[model samples]
Target: MAAKMKGAQILVECLKREGVEVAFGIPGGANLPTFDALYNSPIKVILTAHEQGAAHMADGYARATGKVGVCLATSGPGATNLVTGIATAFMDSIPVVAITGQVRTSVIGNDAFQEADTIGITRPITKHSYLVKDVRDMARVVREAFYIASTGRPGPVLIDLPVDSTVAETEFIYPEQINIRGYRIQASPLIDRAAIHRAAEAIAQSKQPIIYAGAGVIHGTAFAELLELAHKTHIPVTTSLLGLGGFPETDSLSLGMLGMHGFEYTNYAVAQCDLLIGIGARFDDRVTGKPDEFARRAKKIHVDVDPSSINKTVVVDYPIIGDVKQVLQELNRIVQAPDTRAWLATIQKMRQEYPLLYREKEKLLPQFIIQEISELTKGNAVVATGVGQHQMWTAQFYQFNRPRSMITSGGLGTMGFGLPAAIGAQFGRPDAVVWDIDGDGSFQMTTQELATASKHKLPIKVAIMNNQHHGMVRQWQDLFYQGRHAQSEINPVDFVRLAEAYGCVGIRVEKKDDVRPAIERAMAITDRPTVMDFVVEETEDCWPMIAPGKPHDQMLGTYETLKQAGGVPQHRRSDPDEEAKLSLG
Candidate 1:
């Protein structure tokens, strides 16, 4: 049975069938028909301040809720605005379906107003793309877009719907199942049993085994499985930036984050481990740090759903391609605990020697603010961040105890991602407390979203680490550019006034004692959004940095105590490599 309906109506019906509760976007002339269809629908539409914000909002919703997030835009500029957000999702493997309105099918290529090659432009960034030319194809395209976006590695998908198709009538028959040729997702039962056994054997045999987890664990909903495997094996765990909440940081076996700005001991563990079990983790350059030297002594076993990711970067001894949760389940059934008492002792010693620390200055520090927020929230809030020094500080300081708790721009490092992302996260988890720990530079990038938050009366708290300059850029200039200030210095703005103008509560804290009170005030306000601008020390830099192309063991700024006490392991101490000569300051 089929019902004749306009293409736009059919598209909304398809969305309803897919169980979409909400969408984020702004309406434009080309998408008027689709907007009209949405007007009478059950789904709620969040009209964003900008298309880019809409895309990030969708991404944030997906990351927070583990659902395929949806966003809509018109052709040309509206479509172009989504590029950065789409790319961010693609890089981080967030599931998002971006629908764009194109010109009429008759005038698509004839220099029509607001027409752009949406499909061609987004092909590289999207997992898949479609241009619906006929009303009959509208339902199928929407179905395929959602299917592709939510399956496999899970990335963004784009559908460019021509305006004429929205007006055209079609016999709508939403497909109950999708069967795309040459497209197959590796299901749990189909996982290779032999590889799972082999990986288990390797884990059991290793004396110093480490579980290097990534965002894949979160995406595959395998945090419990990952926990089971680690506890069963008695192996220590270290995660990539995006992998923070995949394992509880409070666990004794946890090594926190292990990368550029990761804990000093976590990097040491990576250097010393004999077996590296990378479950749902890509050995990214950020984590690997000088590929040849990364885990030089460790035999690697990589488990991923995508086959191409295996041997795509650093080659591994055992490659198992399967869903992370399923693979971990199989491994847990047969895996035996290794004798890791001595290894754990060594890591504990390292942890004690080089704990994350910042100088106790008279001026407020970003690390203290993050720790305060973590304590005030009881480590149970959904925290999002924009890229820069503040981002790393949050990663270093915030104690994440649950999955999907830390939303950030990891692979893409997109500035201005926090405000919109926080707004989206609030929508996805309406009851959960959401906070955006953003740098001043990053906050200014998408501060306009504050209006959107106020419009919806979403109670998302924002803490701005106002360092008066592009903190990370300034740090790099100090280290590599001979201390030239360059143009990193940003002129100050009254964020308090700006927030009030957006119809939100605003607070500013400039002293050490004012930090906690300001945060408490913001936290108390649950009726609407709140912004706290803490004017921090201008020259404070994120420490324990591993310079580019340097080995993780050659990290700079291992607090003076480690040097004076000679507590750093002999092997883990920085060698006199040329790069090591770079200033620790």
Candidate 2:
């Protein structure tokens, strides 16, 4: 332990102890002392274009590597700018440690220059927050923040250090173990035999079963356990948006994403299953459109580390609260494979009958572009996305085979998250090919980060699907608003010029023939990030659609979708047995 160390020096040392190799942030007046300390530290600090970008980059790094990402910022607006990024991480359960500089402790209430109530401002968004008043507590605070951020049900934790304390000398002693009284960091790894037995009994009795997985499985590194359980039971799997890559999408049991814009058969399987085993998944409202109608026939067994998420949305007949990997290990040990050939046959029939379809087009389609990218990458890339149509396309088409291969803002659905996130992903996994699949509007929001990546020589690939409008909102208008375009349209910017301005090589892929060659060229460039502007069909809609205010089964894709809404053909609704099936009894 150092006999005398400044608060800033202590913070840097604590970060080194936490094994943080790289952090993202922009330094300002209030955080200068901390930045000065960072200069002499072993950890590499990436100065971003903006604080929001820094927060998102940290989140991306954390999500990509399954490590607690670190970010730094100054007071007032600098701290405030991090609110959106923090909220995004909190919503998605990404682990991050956000450090912000504050005003002097004496003038905190007086609103000194660049002063802000950082802890209070970020309180709602963070898993935990602290306002450091004493220099002696600096090391302990940093250790605690990392501990909380990376523990069970990980999310962002914030620590606000006053500028006064940053320069104050203190005896440095890092805490070996945290003793937060009310917090339980680890769920008991001991298998509950009774719970395992009950779950096994339920599975044994179930004629039809479906596994609904989410991001927690990936966070817990329980994909192997999940896969084993699925294979042993011969059950099919459907994942939430964030859960992409948690299961091998190329597997026969895999049913891609199950929510709005999900596969028709996947939604049907979820709705019709006698037992829906939700592994590390919350029944999010987005996943369960018309909550009462979602998976009504299923007797759900929900497994999650967070107790609050269980039974919060859809009803659960059985709740298992523990680490996903641990719980899954127990379930796999006790449960035997049931004869689900008949149920699987029915699902396979549905899958073949009503597969996802898109019209062949002469104009370049965003879906086609994304699908091609997936094929080229072969599910090996660390793919990130900005929210909107592009995000959905990436989620649907890309076959994510490994954990941490797919990164997106699932819960918050933040626009402008892709480019910066890809930068972070590239930083964390430099050997992996990192792609930012982005929509024009979303890309425009955080495109300035291109400079940061370019300056740092991060060779990330950015593919912008330029649709000339806010495509998701436009799709909504096209569907429900009598063809009124309304205010969904936005001005188009020349993305090639924009990329060049940021010192990045820009490729324009307007024709189908150019797309592959352009991608190859971009992949070959290892010196700096590459941007590709794909001007896609202006109003192309994402298919396998579940319209708003409708059940997941009420899909509208092809003419086949109209054939059945409630299990029976639309024309055979009056049939007594078919009607019974429709009633979901």
Candidate 3:
């Protein structure tokens, strides 16, 4: 029998019924009733210092566990703080349900104390949003929020609850059946036979074909199907940054990450292919460079669950609107693959010629550190990254062997995303090794999350590439503005001390030799979190950069480092323990 309960109680009970065991959030005046409801609940609530961090934690948890992440925030300032993190999840198509408290329903539009327009503010970024004025609507809204967030083309969903409505009495009837009008949320589409056949025919006939996969492949849990398709056809695969772990990076068919900071050969393959099969990937500017010039030689075949994303950017010759897994499964059965021995030879030669190598000096290079970490973990660790140079280095260097292993802020490029995300991932996959590779500038943005992790006893590892500048911004200034680096130089902060203050074990590596040992030591610890501060090269820049509006083939620094190497040791620094003052990282 349904019993009388407050709306907040019904909301919590609904979440419990939805199988939410953990939540990340902060409590405030507007959410006191919900907090009171949560007091006796079985759910584990992690209170983060900032609402943004809480949102990211939820997103990371969602990505790692293949479930919707939940975060709570009070109205006004707290809700506003969640916007960036919400946008980040939305852009990446992560499943997250963000619940924000609002002012009393009676004073919602009167500009009451601690009131802001959360529904209006979040409408643009969320897949769907709700303004719950009626207390009875709470249970249904929570169910809808999770359903919308986790299905179709997964994205963030928002719920704005008035304080008064939440505290009001309601008959608790957690909806076992939901009927949302005009909204169909399912994994697979109504399979179109003709479109699948045509896509298959195009694949069979093409001499030079490339499979470009994206995050959708991960979301669909279709990596096996993707690998089967690739293996059966013997097609070389290249991935977007978000798609890194979608295909096995160590496989012979793998061409690594493709785009602005992508492997040069991968871009070449995408541009020169006779057939470009974009599976579950929107051709973002970073991938396409200039839409008009991108894949000019290819007859494009685009497959996506979202109809709007098809031909929204780069026009497609054949568009298939369906779940990527379902489409690939059908395609594999009906189609015949090709022998790309000649194509493989061509790509191999390009790969050998245009390798990703930096002009190394005595000082420790951030890229090398990432490579070492990858080797130590054997591509088994769940790695997350903050934006900028460190983020790029992690993508370029760390070879992910499985889907959902690499998590970063791809679409929104949110700074301070790494550490908090690592915390969330650790919670989601408690047995998996989780690491946050962060830039100094980005790490400081959510450094306070370390305290949260410490309190929860989450054994997350953080590696901060301390390159004393906003690395990516400084890189652009160095190249485009003729070295006029304004305000990019960051004020120095001792991250080691900061971590210690937050009750985390801290390690600092000033020498190239100490990086491996330090990382190993951190991995050995099982009781708490640890932060590694590596004071890396200050002037090193991420290369293979496609300047804005430029074509993929027109990246500026390609092959320059290879020419400079000439056959000597790739990295040569004056002293083993010297600072990274006069070297490339």
Tens-place lDDT digits, model 1, residues 398-450: 88879999999998899999999999999999999999999999999999999
> Where does model 3 exceed 4 Å of error?
185-189, 565-585
The collision pairs in model 1 are none
Model 1 is weakest, by summed lDDT over 10 consecutive residues, at: 576-585
lDDT of 3: 0.88
The C-alpha stretches of model 1 lying farther than 4 A from their native spots are 561-585
Model 1 compared with the native: what TM-score? Answer: 0.96
Task: Tally clashes: model 2.
Answer: 0
Which is the leading candidate under lDDT? Answer: 1
Question: Please, what are the lDDT tens digits per residue for candidate 3 over residues 1-585?
Answer: 667899999999999998998899999989889888998899989899899999999999988889999999999999999999999999999999999999999898999888999999988999999989999889899999999898899999999989988989979887889788879643444877699899999999998999999999999888999999988988888988999899987677888888899887778877789999999899988889899989899999998889989989899999998888898899989889876767877777677667776766667789889888988988889999999989988888888888889989998999999988998898899999999999999998998899889998888999999999999999999998999999999988898888899889999998988989999999998889999999899988887788888888888767765457542222211111122211211
Whichever of 2 and 3 has more lDDT, that candidate is: 3
TM-scores, all models, native as reference: 0.96, 0.95, 0.96
lDDT of every predicted structure (CA atoms): 0.89, 0.86, 0.88
